[model samples]
Target: MNLCELLQATDGVLLQGDARVSVQGLCYDSRAVTPGSLFVCLPGLHTDGHHYAAQAVAAGAVGLVCERPILGLPAELPVVQVTHSRRALAQLAIRLYDAPARRMTMIGITGTKGKTTTAHLIASVLRAAGHKVGVIGTNGVCWPGYRQPLDHTTPESSDLQRLLRQMADAGCDACVMEVSSLGLKMDRVTGILYDIGVFTNLSPDHIGPGEHASFAEYRAWKSVLFRRCRVGIVNADDPQTEAILTQHTCRVVTYGIDHPADWRADADLTLLRQSDFLGVQFTVTGPDGQARSYRLPMPGRFSVYNALATLAAAQVLDLSVAAAQTGLQKAAVEGRVEPVPLQAPFTVVLDYAHNEAAAENLLTSLRAYHPNQLWVVFGCGGGRSRVRRFGMGEACARLADFCIVTEDNSRGEPLPQILADIRTGMQRGNPRTPFVEIPDRRQALYYALDHAGPGDIVAVIGKGHETTLQRGNETLPFCERDILQKYMKARSS
Candidate 1:
């Protein structure tokens, strides 16, 4: 594309670039700069991209997209200055990628939790309805036969456009993605128009440095997705639903379990079982007066909401309810209350409940199975809020019959200190709750398993579906399910 055309998409001032220059590619990281590339200088939380402009130029970056005036680099280097480099990057990427999302039906799911599971449910429904679907979320950027791990729930805008272009090239009919508050706040999805925007639910999360400054700001950022989509499918049962929809420009469709909605799930037929697999079975009623029974292999009330939101989206797309039901019945999310098979007579589930709210929900869901004893092994991530440590501790102390506190990617924080903080919360919540301190997460699993009785429910929380443990600057391979399976085998033999 011509340099003028690209800069026009970003409303940027061409400080030095020739208007007729042909741009070959775009890059944010200086290390990825190639000949004739335009380097976008984003002001990140850790380091300023402006500092790397010199390196990008040295590596053959022909032009620069920046928020501030350039210095230190060659004065004659082509530069495009925008009010916000990140937003400009999104706009530039959309134009460069030929607006791939516009060519395909784009579904965006956002909230504090359930984004991944809900996205999976939507993809399943779409695929069952005979559409080739692409998914980008917490799990990864995935398509029919391809998947690559993602470092962010919503990737940077430039990468997001590139991914969408790849999906379009792969012949996908639709794309479903999880949009994070940080991504929305930073204008990562600023340019791509969404066909459907689904809001699962919201809670206090991602609040601190490098994230939202406050809950209000977080909520507002989440609402941004609604403005960018054609249809807004929201969880009507959520307390913040009204606030989120106050200024939404899209056509609204609501779904919920409590409040009356376009699509509502009735838990009257809901059944919780801890037999061979932990799961829930229920029925949903749509605005068309059609009711269908659905079973999700994944357990919990939250699963119902995820299913309902997905069904609602499917309904908006005019997909058959039968297809949605079939998709829901077969849907399974990894590390999301995932059942680990064992012949030890007790049930073991793996989940990624790292926060107080998620932990509380997970434990409460497990309690519905009426286990002989609900055992929980949980820990807080290192270098995060100490408040989260206390919160998770208090949640387990109040809900679980037995608690085993362990390590969870301590990063740079001392394991002992994190455990001590949890201890403080547990003491305040339930001083009499029997608990044990196990620093090694693998050993923590064994400790819980060794002490479990028949019909007991042991939940290994935090780091669900994660394959690595981060300590300081290094990340080592670590899978909770592998640890459990190996231990169970060794014990049986």
Candidate 2:
């Protein structure tokens, strides 16, 4: 692509140099710059990208996409100035990747909870329907033969665009992704128009410094997806459904268990079974006035909502009801309410319920199983809100019979201090709840597992599906399930 054409594509003002230079590639990171690459200078929280413009130039960048003009760059070096470099980068990436998102059926799932699970469900259904599918979420990005981890729920725009292009080239007929509020707020998904957008549910989450300014901001950002998609699928049971639907320009579809919606599951048709492990059987009525029964291996009220939204998405995508049922039955997301097998009579489950709301939901749902004792083990990450730590502690203390406070990614924070904060919340919530402090996560797991009596359900929360544990600056290899499996094998021996 010519520099002049790329500049025109972004509507950027060419402040310096020749526009005739042919650009071979685009990169935002200076370290990744190659010959003939156009470097996009993005403004970040920790550091401004403009400082590295000269370095990018030195690394053989022929052109620059920046917010401000560079002073020391070669006079002949092409410099295109834009108002917002991040937005421009997203725009440029779409074009650079030949607008791959438009080539496939793009399905985006967004909300405070169940986004990842909903995405996986949708992908599974699409695959079952004979469509090659690609997925991008917190768990990571996956295609036919490629799987890679992501640092965020949504990758930066350039990377996201490249991945979408890869999926398209790999012959994927559909792509499902978890769209984060931060991704929308940051304009990472600015140019791509989704074929279908689904909202699982929302709550007050990710609110604090460096995340969302307030709940209003978070909700608004989450609602941005509806405006950019052809069809909007939402959970009608949520109280804020109307608020989320306000000013939405897309075609609307709703799904829920407790409320009237375009798609819904009647309470009489819903059944939850928990003889040993939990499972849910429900019949969902789609927009076409047809009921499709689904049996999910996982059990919970939220699981039903996830299934409902996925069914709605499948219907919107014009997939058959049988496909939705088969997909729901086969779909399983790792570390999401996943049960870890043990030879003991007591059952143990692992989940990514790191927040107060998620912890409450998981533990409460488990309580319905009538376990002899409901045990919860969880820890808050370091450098996050102490309020979150306290809230999680209070939730576990109030919901579980035994609460085990342990370390979870205490990056650069003292483990003892984080545990102390949790204890404070526990004391305030229910001083009578037995609290055990274990700084070592592996040791905490041993304690939780060793103490479980007959018919006990031990819930291990946080760090679900993640393979590494971050402590200080180190990301040590640690898969909670793998560690537990090894322990169970040794215990059985």
Candidate 3:
């Protein structure tokens, strides 16, 4: 592709210097620059990409996409200036990938929770209905008849475009991606015009100095999905759903469990496997259509919403009720409310609940099942808000019968200080819940497993499906699920 053509797809930004520069590749990082490559200058949280502009040029960056005004450069090197680098990067990447997102039917799910589970259910149903569906979310990227390890929930703009192109080339007709607040705010999904956008729900998250400055900004970023989409599917029951939907210029579809809605939940919602591990069975009703029942392999109220949205999304995608039911029955997410295999007559769960809201939800659900005791093991990220850390500890102290404070990715922060902040939160609570602090995550797991009774339930939180634990600059190899499984098996034997 020529530099002239790429700039045309962008906001008509002037393409200075040679318009005939045949771009061979694209890069956002200066280290990856190569001959005839289009180097994008993105302003990051800690690093300004503009400083590396000369380095990119020195490394043979023939084309430059920058937000700042271009000054000194080879008179022949093509430079395009845009108001925003991230958006421009997405547009350019899409063009470079030949607009693969436009070629395929794309679905995006956003909100603070249930996005991963909803995406999983949708991908499963699509595959069962004999459609090639590609999935990109917290559980990792996969397509029908394919599975691939993913490092980021929402990858870099270039990686996103590259992956979409790969899926399209592999004959995938549709793709479902988890749209994060950060991803939308940063322009990761900029060029991809979504066919369907689903909002699961929202809560206080990613709100701090480096992330969203406030709740308003966070909500604003989630709204971007609805705007970018042509058809919006939202959980109408959520308190903020109307706000998100109103911002949409596209068509809207709503799903709920309480009443006869566009995608409604029928009567007789039961918690399947409630006595042992949790699961749910519910009937879905579409307007002027026969209701279909689904049996989810997972539990909780959120799972109900996840399946409801899946049914509606599947209906829109031309799938039968039977197909959606079958898919929901077998769909399982990796780290979101996952059940770890254990031989003990107790329940052991692995989840990515690292905050007060998620932890409260998980522990409260378990309490409803009347477990002998609920043990929660969680820790705060080193560089995140201390308010959240304290809040999560308070929630756990108020809810869980037993609490084990453990290390969770204390990158560049002192372990003792982080634990102290969590203790400060717990101190303000009932002050009766016993908490044993173990900086070693593995040691914490051993203590929790060794102490819990047969009827007790243990929840290992923070680092759900992730395989690494960060301590300052070092990322120790760790998988909470895998570690729990090994300990459980050893304890049983």
- Taken over the whole model, the C-alpha lDDT of each candidate is 0.88, 0.87, 0.84
Each candidate's root-mean-square deviation in Å? 1.5, 1.6, 2.1
Candidate 2 lDDT, 1-493, residue by residue in tens: 8878776667699898888998888898899999989999988877888999999999999999888877888888888999999999998888777889988999998988888888998898898899999999999999889999999899999899999999999999889999999999998899989999999888888898889999898999998899999999999899877778778999998889788899898775343544345668877787778776788877777888888888888888889878988898888888888888667788888889888888888888888778899998889999998989988999999999998888899999998899988988898888899878888899999998789998888899999889999998899999998898899789889
The candidate 3 region of ten consecutive residues with least summed lDDT is 267-276
Candidate 1 pairs with clashing backbones: 411-472
Measured against the true structure, the TM-scores of the candidates, in listed sequence, are: 0.97, 0.97, 0.95
Q: How big is the positional error of residue 357 in model 1, measured in Å on the Cα after superposition?
A: 1.1
| Candidate 1 C-alpha lDDT tens digits along 194-237 | 99999988889988998888999999999988889999999999
lDDT of 3 by residue, 295-348 (tens): 887766777888888888887877987788788887878887788767777778
**lDDT: worst 10-residue window of model 1:** 267-276
Candidate 2 segments exceeding 4 Å error: 268-277
Residue ranges of candidate 1 with Cα displaced over 4 Å: 272-275
What range of 10 consecutive residues in model 2 has the weakest lDDT sum? 268-277
- lDDT at 469 for candidate 1? 91
Ranking by lDDT: 1, 2, 3
